[model samples]
Target chain A: MSNQMFHTSKSFDQDLTETTDLFLEMGALAGQQVAQAMHALIEGDMHLAHQVVEQDSAVNQLEVLIDERILLLVAKRQPAARDLRYVMAVSKGVVDIERIGDEAAKIAHMAQQVAADNSGTYSYHEVQHLSNQVRLMLHSALAAFEHLQVERAFDVMRSDGNVDFEYQSAMRALMTYVMEDPRQVSHVINLMWILRALERIGDHARNIAELVIYISSGTDVRHSDFETVQQAIDASKIG
Target chain B: MSNQMFHTSKSFDQDLTETTDLFLEMGALAGQQVAQAMHALIEGDMHLAHQVVEQDSAVNQLEVLIDERILLLVAKRQPAARDLRYVMAVSKGVVDIERIGDEAAKIAHMAQQVAADNSGTYSYHEVQHLSNQVRLMLHSALAAFEHLQVERAFDVMRSDGNVDFEYQSAMRALMTYVMEDPRQVSHVINLMWILRALERIGDHARNIAELVIYISSGTDVRHSDFETVQQAIDASKIG
Candidate 1:
């Protein structure tokens, strides 16, 4: 290749790497926000809860920044085929990460309310366990994306089922609480919203995992059953 | 411009138009699904509820198709500046629309559960009102997007507050049922989930409205307070 062509291609690669790095930075920040929100919820730390809410703007800013970078990258490079897929995957992944941050902020807002209402005291054990599982799924999902590890992505997908199971158990436990003392209904509902947010966080993480598989294998596993996703990934491997 | 250049530009515009038409089709379908889901929930129509669940695949298919078209458009046309923003806006809008479809299916699933347990009957009056508001917001949001009407987008954004208020009132009403008779906790929770889905649908619609504003004015109003968004749009108008 000519020197000018070589230099242009090299810079395009650099631009892609830099954009991916920024995207991952956003993912990591979102994960931290979720963790802090969970901590605030369990410990009833109003200060930390407030912090999580405030820090959500940082994630939102990153989303805006990364979005611009992707648009510029596409405009300048006009990458095709796999390169285009990778850019599109990152674009979608940024949305999921930003949503994860939104969910974290939501959990923090509920934590503040829960803290203020001392009468709403209920068991945090289930909530804590479920949050832990969700955080891990998110963490691993990002890791898989960073490294293009399809196997790890599949693991995250499988673990989403466990999150769902845990969510159901927690819901049942809260229902039992409401049954035992109907007055706790208001408080239990708040906890239910928090659980619901965590469940959604898991779903977003699973979406990222699906994007990872799509980026690596060029297969659209979204809207597919687990068996179908697994089989598609396996077939991609053999091919 | 040379005839060749003019012909290429015209074809690019045609491609853009075709892609946008498909996106609007998806949005229309999603709105219908949400409306149908509400009807199913209110009337306890098992067949309609089942049909909503099955029809979700169609929405999902449209999402996959739209994604591919957007990717190809970007790759081939290499849209820049305002053109790039429009493409990206449509791309993100598709995600929000698909989520609306998912939420509708979720409502349908809960409707099935409510239909199975006839004794769980509670007042659907508040739920119906909330669903109607959410559906209107979604429909207006899409219309705003299709027409690129910033004023209409602002209207949709402003209405989201009403949806939130309605959601809270519904929550309190459900809490009353649980408190009056704790045995109704399970049934109340089912209704709560449906309400929650409707509220989320409202959120997704608001997101599309944000995209509409972004596409038209080149100003992203996401993550902004309503007052700020209004001010920004007004300033854009004056400038």
Candidate 2:
């Protein structure tokens, strides 16, 4: 009887591993959608913007699928201890990814709006810089998840501050443009909204990175001082 | 040795239960603060607003306490299946509560701004009405949590639509007030910001309710149709 129980448990573990891999694939797809949205905005490619919007539905579907799978696993497999933590982390991580997809769609919508203006009134350069920063953060954070690399996750979290700063700078520049020529305020405000959405994408990436650190180290790094997270990351590298 | 292990597990479960009770108490306190913030806004009472802001530190401290306890429980107890789900839900619930506290403080700050105006030009009626609606939602949502009443949670989610409608109406009224009298646009805009914050609070409450359903039923009620959550709630009651 004991040997039979052991075999059953081993099979359960294997099934969970397979489920986790599927979740990671979904995360990769969501990350690619975000990057593509940014690229579309930078290139003023309306077709690519539409593609990002279209892809969001798939990401949303994946979120629901992963959520259902996690719930079923908990009910059936009764994962304990470390496996429990891993499942819960993936559940929350997918939420962050789904929100990132929403933010990307929001950016794409902004791109469409800019395209409709037909006035060539708004420049995409500032938005391009903001998108690049956010995309890099998303990529690094997802990579951290793939490797469970605590230090890389920490780097992603720290990068969020820079993205936010760039967003603020972009906002100020846009404000100045609006103030100088009030006629352009409407178009520029739309661009500002896109920049804000990109900034929010970075925030969601930071959330995922925080989750990664928590899942790997069993620590609640949120609300901790930056220095503490950094120190924890360094310690994790050695320990 | 088997007996000793059983005793240890029982003791750990008792500790976890106690920790969860404390978390619930903190949640109730946070809800009260949110209600008082709305009251302060409606009454134009800066003293009460300041009190709410000062008390926010307590809410923040409780959030950290809850996080620490959750981490400790997961590490020590290695709770399986349903117990693990409950722990994860509690952690996420505390986060929603913390955000609600932040929103209350934001409302208090807005109240302070309105009080500072001294213009005596802006009528507080619409703001009062909007605050009342938000307070009703907050109160109902907390009651649902306290009772574990799924129907009450569903009610809270549905109430969000009303709150949002009132908020948009308030916005429209404020915009008209500003356009009709350009001199007051700045003050009206500030008031609009406060209204938006209150609407966001309602959104957070809905989030908590969705989480409650998920915790109880292992269902991902989010992104699903309203009827689905309602049906889940009904099924849980029957079971």
Instruction: Give me the TM-scores of chain B across the candidates.
Output: 0.94, 0.86
- After aligning candidate 2 to the native by TM-score, how far in Å is the CA of B150 from where it should be? 1.3
Over B12-109, each residue of candidate 2 has an lDDT whose tens digit, in order, gives 76766666676677777777887788778768799999999999878878877876676567666666555665677677677667777877887888
> What are the runs in model 2 whose C-alpha is more than 4 Å off?
A1-16, A36-57, A72-84, A109-120, A183-185, B1-19, B29-61, B71-85, B104-129, B169-195
Model 2 TM: 0.79
Error of 1 at A141 (Å): 0.7
Clashing pairs in 2: none
What's each prediction's TM-score?
0.93, 0.79
lDDT of the candidates, in the order given:
0.87, 0.73
**Candidate 2 C-alpha lDDT tens digits along A93-172:** 88778878888887888778777865546678888888878888888887787667788888898888899788879877
Chain A TM-score for candidate 2 is 0.89
Q: Pick the candidate with the highest lDDT.
A: 1
Best by TM-score: 1
**Clashing residue pairs in candidate 1, if any?**
none
Clashes of each: 0, 0
CA-based DockQ, model 2: 0.20
